[model samples]
Target: MRRLLQKVLDKSQKAPTQDAPGSTASEITPQVMDGVGTGSEAVDNTQAVGTNPIKISSVQRLGFQNASNSCSHRDLGFTGKIAGKWYAVFGDTLWCAPGVKDPAQDLPGFHGMVRDSVSLLTNDPLTVVDLNLNNDSPVKHQLQFVPFNPAWGETNMYGFGGTSLCETDARSGTGAVYYLVNANDAGLIGAGVAKVVVKSGTPTVTQRYDGTKGHWWDAKTTARYGDVAAYRDERSEYIYLLGHPPSTITGWLAASYVYMARVRATDAFDLTKYQYWWGRQQGWKTKVLNVFTPETAVMWGTGQGQISWNAYYGCYVFVHLAIGGGTVHLRTAPAPAGPWSGDVQVYTAAPIDGGLVYAGVAHPYLDASGKTLVVSFTNNNHIEVIKVAFTK
Candidate 1:
C-alpha cells in the first residue's frame, strides 16, 4: 500500500494538471450537535423524541409480506444503502428476498434468512426487496436464495472491506468488485468466510497513480472477514478501506479487539500489498474499557457503517455498539489501518431485544450545513438519527 501511495504521489508530481474529475476540493467538516437526547422516544408522524432531543425528520419502513398475510421473517437486517436504495442481507438463514420497497404505509418486500434444506414456505430464506419509497405503492421485487448466516457472520453484501457497493468503479468503470462468502473447510464454520470478487476490465492497465502491474484480487486473501468501511477522500482519487477482524462474539455479542487494513483505489487488491493501518483492543482503564468494551456483540444482522476520514487528525471515525450493552461508541483511528486513538463514549442504552436500535447500518449522514455529522441507525422497527458535533 505504501508503494501504491508513493506511486500516486510521484504521478501527481509529474502531471499536476491531471485532476480526477468530480473530485471535491472541499474538506469534510463535522460538527457535533449538543443537547441531543438519548433513549427511545415517541414518534408523531415520523418524528422521534427522546432524552437526546434530536429530531427525526423522516421515517421509512421496509419488509415483504407472504400470501398468507404475514411478514417474511423478523430477523432481516439491512446492512448498507447506495444511491438511496437499501441492500438487505440475510442472517441465520440461507434464503432471502433481496430488494424490497416501502412507500407510504405499505410494506412490499420480505427481508429475512433461512437455513439450508429448509422449505421456502416453512424455512425462512434470505431475501432482498426493491422498494419505491416515493410512491404510495409499496411493492417489492424479491431476489431469493441469497447465501448468508449470522452464525457464520456473513451479513454484508457490499464490496470487500465495505468500501463501495457491489458494482464497477464509478470513475473509470474499468474495475469491479462483487460481494461473496465462502465456508471454511470446516463447513459453514464461524463467521463463515467473506470474500471480495475483483474483476479488472483492463488487462494490462498500468497503475495511473503508481506504475505497478494490475491484476484481480480476492478479499479472502486480501480483505478477510472484518468490518469493511470506506471513505472518499477530498481528492476522491483515494478510496480507503478499513478492514477490521470479524466480531469475536456471535448472535448479539461483542469482542475485545478490532483490527483494520487500508487499501487504495490505485493499489492492487492483494493481502500482501494491503497495509495494516489501525486497531483497538480492550484497555485497562475503566473509562477506556467502558468505551471500548469487547463485551457487546453487534446485532445478528447489522452491517458496520462506512468510516468517514478525518483529515484533520489523519484518522477515520465510525459508530459501533459496545459489547454487552447497547451504547454506541465513537471509535477513531489515525488511519484506516491504524494504531488508533480515542474511544469516546457517544451514546448508551440497555439492549433492546429485536428493537430498531440494534438492527440497522450506521452511516454518516451530513446535515444541511454539511458541517454537523449526523449518524443514523435503524432496527427492524424504527430509525434513529443523531447529530454529532465535535468540540475540537
Candidate 2:
C-alpha cells in the first residue's frame, strides 16, 4: 500500500504564513470556500492570496520535493472534545484553545481560530490568544456557529454551500455539528445532512436527512456525495459516510472511488438509517441506484481529500490535493472507507500568486505527540501550513 506511506518532516522553525499579498474575492472568501470563476477559469477568483514566504520548521526540516503524482483524497473536518480540550469542527466553527500548552501555546486552535457565521453570536473578533491564529481576539462568547440554510443557495453571508463538493465526515455527534451536505445539486440527484446543534451554545441546524426520492440520485446512486469525513468506526459500531462525485457532475473525480455509507452511530441523522458500500458485494448495500453511478473507487481518488483518524498510525488518514499537483498527499487505511495507500508525497509548496491551490487538510488536534500532524493547504488567499511526521 505504497509502503504504508511514512514520510516525515519537522524542521521546527519556519512555520509562518498569513497570505495577504493583494487578496480579494471578498478577500479570498472571508474564511475559505470562496467560489465563482468557472468555465475553464477553474479558479482565479482574482488571485493574490499569497503567503509562501517559505519557512517550514518541520516537513522533516523540509526535504520532500519529490511528488510522484500519486493523486488520491475529501472534508470540512470533524473533532470535538471541548472542556476536555481537543476541538476542531469544520468551516462551521469551534477550533479551540482555553488552556493549551504546546504547538505554540495551542494559540486559539492554532492558526485557524474561527467562529464566523459572520462571527456567530457577535462578539466579533471570534477569538485568538497568541501565535496569531490569524489575529483578532476577545469574541469567544462560549461557542457559536449556527448557519445552515442561506435559504439553500447560500450567498456566503459567511460560508456553507457545496460547489466542487464531495463531502461527509464531520461530527460531534448527538451534541451536534453532524454534517453531510451538498450545494450545487446534481449529486446525480441526492445528498444531505447538516445537523449543527452546539448544545445550548446557539449552534442551530436541528436536523436534516434528505435520502428517499427527493431524489436518491433518482434511484441510480453510486455514491453521489456526502459530508466527506465522518469516522466513528470504533471497530464498526458504524458511522462511516465519506463521499465524492459531483464537481461539474461528470469530471469523474480524476479516477474516482472513495464512496461509503453507514448509520447507527445511533442512526446518525436517520435518512432511512442508510447503508451502502457494496464494493461489488464486499458488504452493506441496497440504497437504490436504478441510474447514476459515475464514481466509485475507495482508492486512488481526490477532488479535495481529508479523512483523518491517524492517531500516530492507528491508521485511516487521507489528505489530498494532488491531481494537478502542488504535491501534499498522504494516504493510509485500515477502514473508514478505504483500501487506500499509494500517495505519500507529504509536502511541496507552490501556488500562491498564480492563485488556485486547494483543500489539503489534516489537523489531528494540532498534534499532541501524534508525532506532529497540522497539515493545511490553500492558495487563493493562501493558507499553507505543514508539519508532517506521521511516523509509526
Task: Name the 10 consecutive residues with the lowest summed lDDT in model 1.
Answer: 283-292
Once model 1 is optimally superposed onto the true structure by TM-score, how far is the C-alpha of residue 336 displaced, in angstroms? 2.1
Winner by TM-score? 1
User: What TM-score does structure 1 among the candidates reach?
Assistant: 0.43
**lDDT measured at residue 379 in model 2 versus the true structure, 0 to 100:** 47
Q: Which ranges in model 2 have alpha carbons more than 4 Å from their true place?
A: 1-43, 46-48, 60-189, 194-208, 211-248, 252-302, 306-319, 324-361, 367-392
Q: TM-score of each candidate? A: 0.43, 0.27
Q: Give the winner by lDDT.
A: 2
After superposition, the stretches of candidate 1 with alpha carbons farther than 4 Å from their true spots are 1-138, 142-168, 172-225, 228-255, 267-273, 276-305, 310-315, 349-362, 368-370, 378-383, 390-392
lDDT of each: 0.30, 0.40
TM-score of 2: 0.27
